[model samples]
Target: MPAEPLEKGQTRFALRAPSARRVAVVIEGEAHPMNRDPDGLYSAEFGAPAGTLYRFRVTTGGGEELEVPDPASRFQPEDVHGPSEVVDTRAFGRPDAGWRGRPWHETVLYELHVGAFTPEGTYEAAAGKLDHLRDLGVTAVELMPLSDFPGGRNWGYDGVLPYAPDSSYGRPESLRAFAAAAHERGIQVFLDVVYNHFGPDGNYLSAYAPEFFTDRHETPWGAAINMDGRGSGYVREFFIRNALYWLSDYGLDGLRLDAVHAILDDSPEHFLTELARRVQEGPGAGRHVHLLLENEENEASRLLGGGSSDSVYTAQWNDDIHHALHVSATGEGASYYSDFADAPVARLGRCLAEGFAFQGDPSQHRGNARGEPSGHLSPLRFVSLLQNHDQVGNRAFGDRISESVSSEVVRAVAAVYLLAPQVPMLFMGEEWAASSPFQFFCDFDGDLARLVTEGRRREFQKFPEFSEEATRERIPDPSDEQTFLDSKLVWDERGDLENAEILDFYTDALAVRRAEIVPRLEGIPGTGAQQRLVGERGLRVQWPLADGSLLSLLANLSEKESGGFEPPPGRLIFATNDTGPDDTGNLSAWTVAWYLLENNS
Candidate 1:
């Protein structure tokens, strides 16, 4: 904790500046000297109440002086480059005191960006929409990162202040209100957090505390966090405290760690392991506090306990299933999608039965073997999604998956995942198929802005369609304000007749899941789930549930009719199309059906 409120209306301010000869707290243009301890931690107590603007002025050993905001600032009212404000975490009161959160097996996630979720793009506006999500049967709402960034708008991966909620959305109290509102609607709130590296700009840790980062380990953003180097104890504690702050102070139900593979560490006890353990012992001791990961490595070992109360992590974002489904529906085999293009239906079946499609299998994209055997992990250990922020926003045009495939194909894919044993997540506006694109957008100044624009265009140059200079130049500039505005969701589109039909389809599928599937998902073992191919593009998968019942899926994922398959056993639970299998055992193109068979044993 960088700042703490003490008795008698005094505040204790602390900063770790080992390389500085002297450090002072600068409040209202006055410099108050702080006492330095043996470990180079400077501390001082002052009579400062909440909302007092302040910064730290440090004099280096060479006699140069500089000022910077607190690294653990709770709120940045004027954005990342401005002075931090004093915030009392206990000031805000939560209305939903009895909210203990939902179980992992009952989670139906609806991922949304706070800035693009509504027309106002504020936390208050987002809270007003909780009723809509509850009506659509969303059990949880997963928000993209809200950390303070350098500019007015960003995808939030470039956050610099880990503790502060970006002021562009609203005050910290607004976020608490948003969570309370969702809890009132029986919706758990989750946040996406980044701990791999600091953002490219507005980070001042290297100036006073150079040991905060190290060149021994490198990442895409440059030198990795000093998690294993000398003076790493405090660095690890810094991140662990940040995680607890969000969970305890803000009352967030869970956290989705972004890109954990890039968090390279050589310590005997990995930072992730220690962080999860601390969280479980701290705020998670009472309620369900889930910890999720987005590791490209597909390390199933990290996801343990089959969604049990004692598990370190609840689930992981299963990208293998997404890629396989994307390739099968869109027939676009470019980039990483090529890994599943050869046998997409087979891969999809594998993901449905087992946890991952590539369990220790060779990956063409990485030129190496990827993932461990995930067959022993329960289906509840995986979170299945068709489109997330990365899947839609990282593209050159940021086109939603609904735009590339037919509505029938979209509905079929939805039915397959929404009713499956694994947890299902939907990107915002995916149910109604909005027309707006979630293009990558940001607000940076001058040279950095130009570099970001050019870097984004350069990333797509390897593709054949973007090989031409003119085509590449047409790519949207991330720094343009219009790029951010254009990504906002069009709320009116959901009311249109065509889009409403799709919304109804999604609503009904989720209703069926809640009523029929979620109750039986608790004790389903990882093994005994089997997959058999009906034809080139047809898949049949079955899983033995906890109640001794067998849940099944029969999907024809092509544009042509698939024949020579036996009718699925048991009663039909849900189907994408109106018609069922014919007497000749042929399913219509782009059709999916789910069935349930009660066990007499």
Candidate 2:
């Protein structure tokens, strides 16, 4: 049931509870019984002002009474178990009316966690850093989940309350302020939202509406959300409303859906397709909205609206690029990396030439074909990243690439994604190479804490490094406060010479990319960029320009220098090595260089 807004100080509340025998709206210790309709919907009108705290007193089918917050609450001052506050978005109003968002193809995204990005760990603190991101050439900031989870610290994937911003990160107005600050600087903001499963703690939907979940499908977390069973219409409406709330109320530009593959729905119109249509052609029309998915299944059809011309998502996260790069850099192929182990460099080249490496190919890691053909899609339909939260935090030690590989190697890898045609995303500390690690962390108390720690340890047991007991002891406890503290980015380190060198490399690369590639991207060949393997461990990509010129990037992926090769017909634009153009045209180990060729050659 929707919470309808009336006059300034009034709100109309309605709830649907078929199993509830009696329901009352208890506001500030006063009880008001709501009138019920024949369809099991209870309605009540209160003289309550904004910020008034209230909850529902629900009498169960068997006469057991329970007190729970509203399923559609916009704000929870006391979190999940406490009273829900009335948040009138109509009161605060939209901050940036001139903000229509930026072009999706021109976007250079920077993903960050609000808590670990700065020492203050609040929306206000994150907003303070917008100038820094603007200077780094970041067109948008993709924040990790901010939905209200159980405790003070979390990765945000375990959020239970989809509507309320976590109390730990200030109030609802604080988030609005952050979005306003970003838009004022011409930077768009997107929120990462989880719809796969609710957090283990503070999930009250099942307590009142068991029909919200179904045993027909099982997710890695637990029972899947009901999208096609009895009572699924309201369940579907509940999530779609949450998406609209964030975009219209908080002024967010887009949403990065957590894992769409696990959202098992068998309806005539898929949930994601329906969500896209509502956001694009519904009330959100005339406002630019981007929808991105993190679907591991690599279903290219989703980006194409499942072959329907009416619906479409903006893009999908391309994990094949990350896995191939990881195998090439670390040279450690054990679990999922086994598929890319044989020809890691070639795989990386293919990913650059094409959008995905495993498109319809049999993967040894999965023992089956993993992805569908993605050749017919635009390069902008895939988002590539070098280091994301999952790639770093899921590690046994949560170590960054700066700690695992050589500095020169890291620079080459950075140039590959930043200059490629696809959309590039940078993790929080990747630009400056911050020393802190983004480890797996949570704040669960009592027995839950112990169980979470044990589960984490068991997850890493398959890795040969964590097979021994002593090795397991070294694994940081996910429940410890120290783990969260250790993950905060050290902002001061950006000024150091070692870190500044890497940061400058990224800034210059992005500048050259915008100047050369972004303009002529729309009309590129359907086969994507033209690329050829250079010798044994080298690759050269030629991006066609409108003026009949080419933007060429050459790199040596091996540890030894590859010499005696003629340079591409162009003036050198960028090189990872400190030196400029050489007499012999030799490329050092783990070096990448970009050049611009004119119409002459």
Candidate 3:
């Protein structure tokens, strides 16, 4: 029989397990013992009203207790697995305003974290920063996940609730407000959704539906989500429903799925394909509903996912690019950095032109062959970024690309990333080069909190600047007001001459894109791409620009050597480092230059 429709403040729930005893509904401020009927539903009445806080406290015979937040709670306040909050999601919502814009290919993607995007660290506060995003020339805002996780502040990846938004960001209504506001500004809102696994805490899908998990596989967190195991069908339904809720109810333009590599599902029908079919045939039929992934393996098959998607997504974040640039620019050679330093600049150029620097190459870091060539897929199906949250936050010292490398190198790489065929993503405060460390910190339950600290430290003990003790010592307290404050963007710093220059450089590049390139060379078939070594520590890249012109990219890898590039006699459009050889033809240190060929057709 179909379940009864819920009215405001009313939720009907049931569990079939006969072995279970002592079931209670956790309502706002108190726990109410449920009345179990032969029909199997254990329910209770609550005067707690709409937007009440709750979670289920279920106990078994052995005195073992499990606290699972409401399976369908509208919000998670304590964290992803923490106490659940009742919210009339529909009450705080409007009609799905719908995406009214161009395709995702033309988008200027901007990635931001709600906690650090503004001082208030809430959805409402993030809404205020939208104007700044607009001024920065970004057309789409790719938010970090808002799914429930423990504590008010987190990176948002450890979310347990498949549907609820973190209450720390504001009520469910505020997310709708953000999406609406972004649409009003001609900007698309792309939400980051994680379905790989739920948080270690407050997870209760197994009790409600035994088929939502599998014993076949496990992830770093714990048991993986039940997508292919028993109850796989319902698990898929739960996720699809959650995604549809965000899109249809909140009016998100797109959803950037997180860590798809960890989504270990072996179902025959395949959940990804089915979800894609449902979405495309639904309200977002005409406009783009991007499904991005952060797959480390670079499996082209997942992107192709049987074409259920419009090609696996508009793009996937290229961690290879980030890693390569980090090693080259920062001169860091601890762990994964080892594989990148030995990588050739020619490989990076091929990635810029063809997308995949390590396609089929033996990856020292992963100890296996990695990635398919970008030539195997559409150029638009990749997102190139020099810096992102995890790349910075997961660091021993949590240093951003801006802090470790010279602004010159940062600007140089930015040019390549923006001009490349793939979509480009910018972390918050990257534009003004704000000095803030987005470290990995969490506030868990008392017993589990200690485990998290020890676990985190143990994972990084092998790395050079990372000791278990040092790692624990630096773990920022999530409850501390200053941790969030430390991540806020200093908008006024743009007034400083150095930052002003970087800001101007970015503006000019983007203006050139909007006014000139978009009109003249939109998605120009990148060609004549060839690169060569200039001795042991330097290399040069040549790109065939318009009208028989050439753009030369130069980088000096060694501390002692300076690199040079000889243009085919034309004006210098931009330079990423020391002024490339002056008119007298003397190259500067680690210079990266873009010069047009004298159009002598």
Cα-based lDDT for every prediction: 0.90, 0.84, 0.67
Give the C-alpha lDDT of model 1. Answer: 0.90
Using all chains and alpha carbons, the TM-scores for the candidates as numbered come to 0.98, 0.96, 0.84
Per-residue lDDT tens digits for candidate 2, residues 1-601, read 4356678577788778877898898987888898888866788996877788888898888888888888777887887788888788876666688888887877899999999999999999999999999888898999999888878899999888898898888988889989999999988899999888999988876656789899999999999999989988888888998898889888899999999999999988888878888888753587678889998888888884345552288888899999888888889798888999998888888787767888889999999998877766667788989899999999988899999898888988888889877889999999988899999999888999999999998888888888997899899999999999999999999999999988988888888877777765654544546777878788887766555677777888889888644578788777888553366867888888878876676
Per-residue error (Å), model 2, residue 85: 0.9
Cα displacement (angstroms), candidate 3, residue 192, comes to 1.3
- For this target, which candidate reaches the highest lDDT against the unseen true structure? 1
Task: Find the 10 residues in a row with the least total lDDT in model 1.
Answer: 304-313
315 in model 1: Cα distance from truth in Å?
0.6
Candidate 2 lDDT (Cα, 0 to 1):
0.84
lDDT of 3 by residue, 1-601 (tens): 1112266546554333333477776655466787776634467654555555666777754556776766656676566656666555556555444456557656788888887787777888888878877777888998988877777667888777767788788877888888888877878888899888877766665664455677787877677778887546656877887788777767787888788778787777567667766776874686667777787777666564223333545567877777766676776766766677765454565566556677778888778888765555544666888778888877755668888778777776677666554577888778878777776655576878777666666767786555557455675554454655676677778799888888877776665545433332334344455667566545566555444545455555444535344454556656665365555444554555655543363
Better of 1 and 3 by lDDT: 1
The alpha-carbon lDDT assigned to residue 78 of candidate 2 equals 84
Tens-digit lDDT string for candidate 1 (1-601): 5588777678999998899999999998999999999988999998988888899999987899988899988888888878999998887886777889888889999999999999999999999889989999999999999989998899899999899999999999999999999998999999999999888889988888999999999899998999999999989999999999999888989999999999888898889988999998998999999999998988888897534332467899999989988888899898999899899989999999999998889999889999988898999999999999999999999999988988999988888888999999999999899899999999999999999999999999899999998999999999999999999999889899989999999999999999989999987798999999888899899999989999988899989988865666788888887655778978999999888887762
